[model samples]
Target: MHEKDHSEALKARIKSPKRASRRMSMLLGAVALGALTTGAMLQSSFDVGPTPAYAQNLSAQVPAATSAGFADVVDHVKPAVVSVRVKVAVEGASAEGFDLRQFGLPEGSPFEKFFRRFGDEGQRPAPRRYGEAQGSGFFISADGYVVTNNHVVEKAREVEIQTDDGKTYSARIVGTDPKTDLALLKVDAEGGFPYVSFARNAPRVGEWVLAVGNPFGLGGTVTAGIVSARGRDIGAGPYDDFLQIDAAVNRGNSGGPTFNAAGEVVGVNTAIASPSGGNVGIAFAIPAETVQKVVAEIKEHGAVRRGYLGVQIQPISKDIAEGLGLDDAKGAIVARVEGGSPAEKAGIKTGDAILAVDGHEVKNARELARDIAGFAPGKSVDVTVWRDGKKREISVTLTKMPGEKTASAETGEEQGGKLGLSLAPASSVDGADKEGVVVVGVEPGSPAEERGLRSGDVIVSVGGKKVETPQDVREAVKELRKEGRKAVLMQVESANGARFVALPIA
Candidate 1:
């Protein structure tokens, strides 16, 4: 027989339902026939066994050990997760007629009569539109204290939490901190509630994690993944240090707990990155440290009191550092110190670079801001600053940031030269402080203009030294050139604010 005929015969035999009991036998017979045909064509021969050797040795093959499953972890943490539902009042006109067009029911259709018994579609005043939203939360105390996202319960007229076992309870907002997007809620239960504790330490990247929450209104949903990244700043707030995970966290997962391998709450799932409004593997969680801190303050005082340093600061750019004769670009450059603020009282001057706080090194402007805000008002701290090519430590006693709106001056003079600018003493200009030289005019295409120096700007300091008279500015520039410096750092105070400008020394 031809090889094609043999192949066709084997295919037909395998497809025959009558060979159901002999399915394996038919498969083996087909393989043997194919092999025999090839052997005949190639003029070679081989033995055909009743069964394959690999199949016979299946019992001897051992599978690799599998990692522990997540069932136990889910069981331990699922009870603590709760689904939060909120009802918000909506404002609009109420339609009072049965509008057939709204329900897609043809005008005067027979089906409309059947549905009319259910409700007068047009006569029903748009049932006082109540906006309904759902999210997730977890119990933090046995007495019924719960933790959820600030946005979840924000402006909610009625907040309710449903437990894993389907028991629902009305929850009241105890406090909320919008800066960190955290909120605390309370529920009343008779016996007690299953609560979870925040993890003492943060989870490492690549470590296994489980996110348990009510995703898409599905109660007690659990997803598993590893910590993808940490300390992610997505610009959600001023103190944004979120933990990024690859778990399938979707809508309604907000304010839920992300547990570690030990079933400890490592973070609170808050937001997700999805272009299609579904889980695409990227989600963000507020670290447990921040949650703990914010929660404690809320529980104690019913609000979060943040420490603030009254100073306008900016990051030290490469050009600013080079102009200031620094080897590395680090620390925050003090742009303007509030007149009566803690920084001003502590002798923290304009143009000073804040390098450290309480002996802890500050990396940049954001770090400095975060560190300062971590402390409480009326607390004293040691602030180290880099000034005049040297470091100096100053003591500052923080004060509560003012809640009221705060309010600055102007100048003139003309003196043009290699710097391509005009300067005059502030005393010569009206409404100007008599402490620096006033810039009356700037050459259209001069280096001063290129550096953002404009007319009416006051040059408060040059090369780390304060300037009083127009001659003081000229002398500073001459001294910088004599020292072989390529550029001079000028602290200019304008109506907008005070900032450092690096001007080239021609």
Candidate 2:
């Protein structure tokens, strides 16, 4: 691949401006999109297809009178973009029981009268306030509906929206979906207003895109880039299907929209990867397809309702794949099935390798979880699993995830001298004194002692689920042995912090 001129419309959108008054949001968008497009073209240049055409036409028509360039797209979308400001009230320390006036207050009077003279009663100094944060958002509907990131409005007591024209409107939260970091707000505008429409299809790889948002409270900033990658999982949540771009999304750009060349909203700028809190070119956006679904759901219902498949799952590692006689590790491996839950009803069990759901391939447990949760409860779906070296299909009705429940603690008598290490329940400590199996006694030459298993460490989870007692540890070990897995990943919380330790169960 040849180096394209940075100003060849494709690269010009990403170059930094001469002054420091630069908009990080737009810059990061361009960088991310450029990276995405370059990677896609490298893999399959001829596969650019019609997607870029849809994107290019929108970008190419720069207004000639304005020295036609990327800013033209910015001008077209700026009116609909707005800055959201939030204020929060913080509570101060309470003097609940103490009474300074007790030494001299009137006998029958409550402390009110004495405290009033100090002006702390009737004029209770306004609660200490904190957040006065600003972020970017755009109108999604002509009827004054807007979309932004949930983090942009989180904990905000009052939200106000300010357009590029300096007019501000008081906005109310319509709904929010934290799983996707998206929120919807409304303003009471009298008539139709400028708004951006969502693209009917997902933005194709290598397509030009633009981002508009407020960065550092600077209003109505715009940047352009191309789609660098898709279906990126940065571990933000189980449902991470982020569109990676070279567009510069920085702080304050969290809630802005990314548009295709046709001026249609294609992505919602959410995050960027930069150590200095400025755009370094890598950014991520929530795809417009997911945004449309989430926004519509929030508008209809006050909250999101996701389906649940009750089972503990993990990605199939290479060792496990070879042990199971598989070609490669490319699916989710079921570790445990909830009794009487959907997995059990569908004849799914521990050690089953899940290949796909309803014909859509699942690359890992997180992908499977996200796909399943996209559906509503009681919906029937077909699951493909690899068991005993063959594929099988099972139909199951999804259920809701049960509320969090505490597991019983595992207690055991100190067993020492067997494993070269001392082991005991981690009790009587400041943090884990309440309920942790401790490692008390270690023999100098045992494997446990060699592995550095200490006395004060509290085992919190075995194989990713909380284990309350030592008996739970035994059960997990037994199950792992039965499944033929060699190691059990244990999450141990110590006074210092939490760390994962993979203990050999076989």
Candidate with the greatest lDDT versus the true structure: 1
* Each model's lDDT: 0.70, 0.64
Tell me each candidate's TM-score: 0.60, 0.61
- Candidate 1 residue-wise lDDT, 1-506, digit = tens: 89987664444321101100111112121010111000000011111123322222111222322375777667666887899988865544211123455677666667654543445423543344477778889987667788988877765768899999999999887777776788999896565677776777899999888888877776778999999999876656566688989998877888898988777788998877554456777788998888888887777656666555678887888998987777889988888887777888889998998889899998877677777767766779899999998999999987654431010011112322367565777765667787888886554346775555777888899999998776677778778877888888999887656778788764
Clashes of 1: 7
Alpha-carbon shift of residue 429 in model 1 (angstroms): 32
| Alpha-carbon deviation at 83 in model 2, angstroms | 1.0
Worst 10 residues of 2 by lDDT: 34-43
What candidate 2 gets wrong by more than 4 Å, as runs, is 1-67, 91-130, 404-506
- Candidate 2 per-residue lDDT over residues 356-417, each given as its tens digit: 98999977666677777667667788999999989999998986444211122221224211
